[model samples]
Target chain A: MLVIEGLLKRYPDGFEALKGVDVTIEDGELVALIGPSGAGKSTLIRCVNRLVEPTEGTIELNELELTTLNRAGLRRARRRMAMIFQNYALVERLTVMENVLSGRLGSVGFFKSLFRRFPQDDVDNAFALLEKVGLEGLHDRRADALSGGQQQRVGIARALMQDPDILLVDEPTASLDPRTARQVMGLLADLCEEHGLAAIINIHDVPLARDYTDRILGLKAGELVFDGPPEELTDDVLPEIYGGEDWSKEPSEDDEEEEDIRSSGQFLAEEVL
Target chain B: MPVEQREDTVVWRRRDKRQAVIHWFVTLGIAAVVLWCFKLIADDTTWEFVWSAPEQGADLAIRMFLPEWFVDIPQLWRDGELWVHVAEYFRQRGLYAMELWDPLVDTIHIATLGTVLGVMIASPLAFLAARNTTPSTTFVRPIALALLVTSRSVNSLIWALLLVVIIGPGMLAGIIAIALRSVGFCGKLLYEAIEEIDENTRDAVKSTGASGMQVLTFGVIPQIAPAFAGISIYRWDINIREATILGLVGAGGIGMALQSAIDTLAWGQVSVIFLAILATVVLSEWVSAKARAAVT
Candidate 1:
């Protein structure tokens, strides 16, 4: 479980990206945090992991108090929570297998990481995770050579190798096309079920988030204005999230869950086209 | 956008009336301050006196040692006897004959060894010095800065001179000086390279709760390794040139040979050494360019 209380972040330049935000997520829940640009969706998610330090608050993940933990302690806490970035953030110079193996670095001793002498289990697990993401054959390929969608897939496999209890994704689909976005989100949804992991993702695609996630958390200007199941996410709630009407065609209750997205096949066509 | 709004006319010409009359006033003020200070220290007799600054600093050094045969030397041109020694150096064969190649080889050897050692030492030091990579900037930063400044400020020649006196003249003096100097050059440069790397990679690792050491190994090292290699290689080439000069103080290598020939006034041998040095420098330059390109 992840819990936040009276969380606030104010930049030294005086921009309040998060204002007294309070939220909690249960174990194995797939929570979609949806908001438009500069709405602090990413900031809120980052704060949970102590990436952007909360100026004042308590972020409790299991026994770890994120705000109170020193760098080393926070790093130990991080081993339990993996993060997927929008840009993938795979070290471009390293091969896919190396990138995946890096996920175990927090647990592996420092000398082992330097020498890249990850334990046999770690090596096997990395290869297995790569296979799970359907990047089995490209394990040794340079990360920069992969397509954006494929790179994000590699990012997911890397995160899973951490054996994290919770996963936070910040705009995982932002750089991807619509079809690819759907595919990645579907993968996340599948992983949540397969591993029984809790996931919080910051997303801009309202319709896609509605289709993929079990619950939705909406934010606008550093405040959580709406929290409910995906079925309750509607056109009315979007204006509250984005500060204006956008893609205003309301999805009927029957149409809230996308039937068009069946598998990677249909999603690839939308992505490529 | 219209050209008129974007472009402005150049102003070049200035009238005598528009000239800043305060220029002479500033110059006069500076001159007056200098003269005032001078007046406070010395009188007109000293000013009028012909100030013959002595060349005794380097020339008079070590004159009282050994034999009367090595005593007070006349200027080469003034004595008109320099050609005799030049002829003798060229004519002397076997052990007495100065071989430019020997010193050249030594200088190159010392430089290569020093550069390699320094780079090995500085690579991890740079990572420790980077504010983002290290656990604390408070300790490593000042220490790194101090190391860099001290290495750079104390010229390699000075290092060689001191070491030569302590360790006795040989290649070791040259090598130690080059290594010490290159540490400053490479550490300072490599640390900056580490600092300039994109924070995005580190951010993900941090988000995963990577330890400081873990982040450095996975997040920072891969990003900066290539550039670090390039910087260290560049410093190696620079140290090679410095190694040659270090021998002027009796360190070792081709410079020692060159200094001996110069001392003996062997223009023929000196010219031969110069040509060899020129070739080596050009070849090393090309090699350095290739090495740098490979890394970057």
Candidate 2:
């Protein structure tokens, strides 16, 4: 469980990226944060991990106060809340195994991690996670050698290596094609269900979010405008979330094509389950 | 179309006369300064000596390349004594080769040790100078930059000369001088490499709850390793060449033999030492290139 209240992020230059916002996520729930660019979706997820420090809020993770922890305590807390980046930010020069093993950095001591002397169990678990993420035999390859989808798979495996309770993913499929994006979202949904991990995914595609995630949180200009089950996110509320777009227009040919692809993706996701 | 054409023509005709005058003035000023420099050189130098330099060089080349004690062609045909002089020359070269072996070895060792020492000192200083990695920009960055500037401002020869005064002249002075000169070179390149590392990768490493040092190890070091290896190998190649000359300032290397030969007018030994230095440099260049290829 994660609880955030009145979270605010004011940049040093006086730009308020996130205004007062509140959110609570339960265990085993997959929530999609949907908004246009600069809607503070990324900032909200980053705040949960303290990657972006909250200016005026309290964050509680499984009843532990995360906002006021010291540096060491914060690091330990961070180990339980793994993050997946949109760009799959693996060290390009490091091998996949090394990048995955780095997820155990907070658990191991400095010297041990520095020398790359991960425990036997950690190594075993890393290999298992790699297999689980469908990268069964590419552990020795360099991170940059993998394709975009493969790299994101490695990113997911690396995050899971932390044995995290709640995964914070920031735009996981933005860089991938539509087909690969649906596949990645299906994989994440499957992983969440199997592991009972709470995940907050910040995403851009509204149809994918509605079709896949359990719930949706909508933001517009740093404020949470809507929060409900995906079925309740009607067209009327999208205007509130995306700031007064012409929602009454007739569906164009492109929209119909997109709708077909999205419905098929939903069907595929359901079939996988 | 006529109005637009007329307007375009007017605009084209209206050149910036002031700018053109400034450009002409700048060009003329540069030319004047260059001509003044040439006039100063011509006034100070002896033109007769400059004109005679080619003839003087030819005369010295003839004296250096030819020996009056050489056997006549008719005498060689009569007695086969030409092989005797050639064998004597080879024997003398062999003895010089034996004498040069230790100094050549010392030069290589000095370069290796100096490069290692420079890398050791430069790595931490580079972290301090890197904008992203520095602990404190106001304090640490400035100090690191100043140290790098100080190291770079002095040439290795000058550093060797200074060290010889303090250390009383040995391989130690040569090694220290090379190391000091290399610190700035390595640090500047390493810091640039550090600054150019992918910010997203660094943030990803930090997100793993890794401490600062862990982030540096897992994130920063991997990205910089290839650049570091290439820079170190190149510096070692250059240091080998520099080490050959350190002995001129009483720092131990083949330059000591070259200096002694020059002082005593032993041109043959000087030529031999030059050949040895050339061979060492070529070998180092080859090794450096291979190492760089492997690393990158």
Candidate 3:
């Protein structure tokens, strides 16, 4: 179970990313957060673990309020929450199994992990998690060598290795092909069912979200535009959330085809002056 | 458009300040060269100091400091002393000969121990130094920079001198000298490595409710391991050379005998020792390359 009430965050540049948005998820529920790009979807999920700190909000995750917890306390709380990244942020040099075991880093000491002296139980559990995600024999495989689909599967296994009570999946299928995306979504749905884990999946594809999740929470411009069962998600509501009168006018063509944006490292570092 | 027009259209532009900085350096270099030439002609300094035995060391030192021991010169070169003296040294310090065992092993052991120890100290310091990784550039970065400066400010010789006072005369001194130098080097390298890791990986770890320590270990360390290996191994090669020379300060290894041979102006013995040191360094370099390759 999770509770987020009046979660708000504003950028230093004065742009509000999450403007008093609120939502809650019951235990073992497969929920999809559908929105256009920059809909505060990512920001909402990021704030749950305090990755993007809220300007003013109380995020009650488990018993402790995330906004009030100190760094150590937050880390302890984080062990119960796992996030799947859009980019499948696997450590490139580490093997697939090693990357998965990193999910347990919060519970282990710095020296133990550094020296590869992790508890045998954690290692055994990591292998089991990998096997469940269909990467059974690829334990020793380098994370960078895997295909995008395989990497996402490993990402899932890594999150699952945490034995997370709540899963925050941000654009889990954003990079995969339609078939692979469906498979990833199905894998997530199945895991939530089997493990009784609450999951919030942020997705761009409306059709995919409708088909995959039992419930839908729609966001538009840092506001909860809609929240209801998937059956009630109508085309009339889509226009209000996405701002397109006709199918031809909709931005669906540009849906997942956003070009890879590589910001210049030199530009990011130094001031122009 | 014509080719000329196309070429003109593609004219490269430099940022004004960058161009000005480069121009300033060039102008300063030219002015210094002209002043030096003018002074040479005006002063009419004798060319004798360049070739004279007594003044050669001073002149070379002026160009760039030569070892103080090199001040003594025989004014002649011969192969018999070289042959007799070198054969004698090789036979006397059989432990130091290229074909023999202990000295070479000692050199590598010092280098390996120094590199590993330096990395252990520098790894955490690097995190504090990296502007992107550190929470406060004002607080953590200065401490990190101080560590780098302290490590690098004195060369391995000073470290050897210092260690000789504390630990006293042995491989410990050599190892300490190498480690101190490595701290400076690995700090700069690993900080850069830490800065270059993908932010997405960091964000992924942070979202897990992981602490700053967790982010560094799970997210940053895994990313930097290859680069860290490459840098440490590169320093490993440098330490091999430094370790041999460390004995000049009465630390340990082949340098003790090397300084003796050089002090006596026995070129043949010096030549033999130098060649042996060169071979040892080359072999270590090859091994370092293999180790780095395996890691990366």
Top candidate (TM-score): 2
Tens digit of per-residue lDDT, candidate 3, span B1-296: 11223454853344355676888999999999999999988678665754586686655344332322233323212322444544554574454354334655677788889988988898888988998887789887998989898998889989999899999898988898899999999999899989999988887767655667778777887888889889988998889888888888888778877778768764445655777788888898899889988987
At residue B192, what lDDT does model 3 achieve? 90
Candidate achieving the largest lDDT? 2
lDDT of 2 by residue, A31-92 (tens): 99988788899888888888788898999999999989989999999999999999999999
Candidate order by lDDT, highest to lowest?
Answer: 2, 3, 1
Best to worst by TM-score, what's the order? 2, 1, 3
For model 3, the stretches where C-alpha displacement exceeds 4 angstroms are A62-64, A104-131, A228-239, A242-246, A249-273, B1-46, B50-109, B131-138, B161-171, B202-217
Tens digit per residue, CA lDDT, model 1, A105-167: 788887888888989999989888888888889988999999999999999998998999999
Candidate 3, position B139, lDDT: 86
Give the clashing pairs for model 2.
none
List the pairs of residues colliding in candidate 3. Answer: B82-B268
Measured with DockQ on alpha carbons, how good is candidate 3?
0.53
Q: Tell me the tens digit of each residue's lDDT in model 2 across B180-279.
A: 9999999999999999998888888888899999999988999999999999999999999999999999999999988998899777777778789999
* Greater-TM-score candidate between 2 and 3: 2
The residue pairs that clash in candidate 1, if any, are: A75-B209, A78-B208, A78-B209, B103-B253, B103-B254, B104-B254, B107-B253
| Model 3 chain B poorest 10 in a row by lDDT | B68-77
Candidate 3's docking class is medium
CA RMSD of all predictions: 8.9, 4.4, 8.3
What is candidate 2's TM-score against the reference?
0.90
